[model samples]
Target: MASDSEVIARGDWYPAHSSRSAAAALVPRTGELIAIGADGVALSVSVVSALSFSSRVGAIPRRIIFADGSVFETADNDAIDHYLRSSGHKSVSCAYRLEKLHPRILVFALLVILLGVGIYRYALPALVELAVLVTPPIVPELISSGALSTLDKTALAPTRLSEHRQKIIVERFERVASGAEGESYKLNFRVGGLIGPNAFALPDGNIVITDELVALAGGDDEMLAAVLAHEVGHVEGKHSLRQIYRAAGVAGLVMLIAGDVGSGVEDVLTQGGGLLALSYSRAAESEADRRSVDLMRNAGMDPVALVRFFDALEEKLADHSRTSMLSTHPGTPDRKDAILKYRAGSD
Candidate 1:
């Protein structure tokens, strides 16, 4: 080793004239920084200003930048530290200081992850619900139209019921719908196709009753009227729109947590948009059912007809759990039974 004052760092160097780097010592001599090679050749650099001193990463060497855009690197941090303090080079970045403290960085990273998850699981759902509640009526109409068109191509066929039956059902539906709180409804009839005997309402107040559902009633207008009233409840409560928005919000949250936001995975969330119309959460179903009871009473039909219809539908499906309450509406037997109790108490 050279004398303490003659050598600060013994490392590789690339001279201004040389295309190859060589073993050299960074030494201060005559108030200038110099690179001295083993061959006794010395090249001097006028250290006018110290630009920056970069922190070492793992076992990587440290990098030093000079004012002249020249770079110096060394793995000997002890020697480099001695040179910096002795040479009055105090220029260092906060990043360098932080890198020196590894534990703080790990704690900071963990906190950030926890905070993000908490916001997604709790705050995001409430915000989505509030936004859905405040959304304009026209937005639901636009969403419903797209969803209906998709269903028409896949699950629904043209109306198979006779004109007389369509007119009668429409007139009865109109009477109940006029008392509903939602926008004016247009009654639509279609063959249920593969969806089975079902009736569903769109966000924009289009209540579709299938031919199979009509047949299932066996020409009982009271039962069919009860069904229409229930669908009106869905429309008035904006249950379809709320369910879709909640689904979209959850999908977004999943994509965000998975680090796949703005990727093709969004298409997977939106592809079967029509299915949103078919499914109602248990809470949403309950709200609509309650509304249906009121609509039926206002239209002078017994709400008990709804309970009877549900029981009959459950029997016809053969699976007790295959009723509207379990399939998509998603309610418990207690909830199904409550409808009958509600009617009896009202009487």
Candidate 2:
């Protein structure tokens, strides 16, 4: 028999048992002599039986006595495990305790979702409005016109001056525009007599083609159609409008915060045309490509023509060591590859 005043230290394990009589007598039952550890300081604990065996032992409880002389009597294994784990005792089944805190994890997830919604719904629209306020309108037109003129002066001026060829090009543009779905905007094809082979679409739906680019295509109508379709994609997607809005919004916000709203506004209006010349975001580019592919397919033109056009242009520009075409029109190869991949998947 152990003395009631014995002090149990840490790192001890012990066995315990209990019994009751109809006469209500305090009869001590034969039980395992469980080791008492310092972890059970100020309280008494006993391992009734080993439910699991690992680095830590799991067991059922026969009873518990509090420091206040209150006795907790139970035979529930789960209850014993819960109490021990909650009190920071190492157990073979500690994982169950962790699962009990699932509500806390759910609350954290809800907070994240609410934060995302707030940014998208409230913050994004306000930012977009601020951008619109600061952007100058003239910038895009100047860049578009300047880019066209630069191409024309160098590549297509000679061809454009030929009235007959100019008329033919004009008629082709008209034909393509007629078939376009939306209210047709003004479609002008100026032949840039530049030696550098390239073509590009302006935000305002103006399409400029270089003499070198046309020559590279060997004057294939289908290739021209593919190029035109791509330009149409740019217009239909309103890529230019979005670019201008984004730039203006950013400039406006910066100006407003800097306490120089007057100068910023003036600068934005004055440089509006140039700001419009800003490149479309990657998302805009992808959207344009998708639209162009769809347009080409709908127009009874082989979408593969776009692939061929890119390949030919790449070869020609590489031969001349001219990177301007690639620079102005980024992601050509990737777009081509995507088209091919899409076609393969569809088939």
TM-score of each: 0.63, 0.50
lDDT of 1: 0.71
Local distance difference test, candidate 2: 0.53
Candidate 1, residue 212: how far the Cα is off, in Å: 1.2
Candidate with maximal TM-score: 1
Clash pairs, model 1 backbone: none
Error of 1 at 341 (Å): 2.6
Per-residue error at 158 for model 2, in Å?
8.0
Task: Give one digit per residue, the lDDT tens place, for model 2 in 1-347.
Answer: 23334311112222233332111101111321233323332233223232232322233333343333323333344544554564455763555445555897889868766765665557755766565455364655665566555544444454443567556655655555555655354545444433356556665567666666667788676777677776677766656655555555556655544445555434333442343336666666666666556666666667567788778877766765445556545677688888777666644
Computed on alpha carbons, the lDDT of every model, listed in order, comes to 0.71, 0.53
Q: Give the CA lDDT, 0 to 100, for residue 29 in model 1.
A: 61
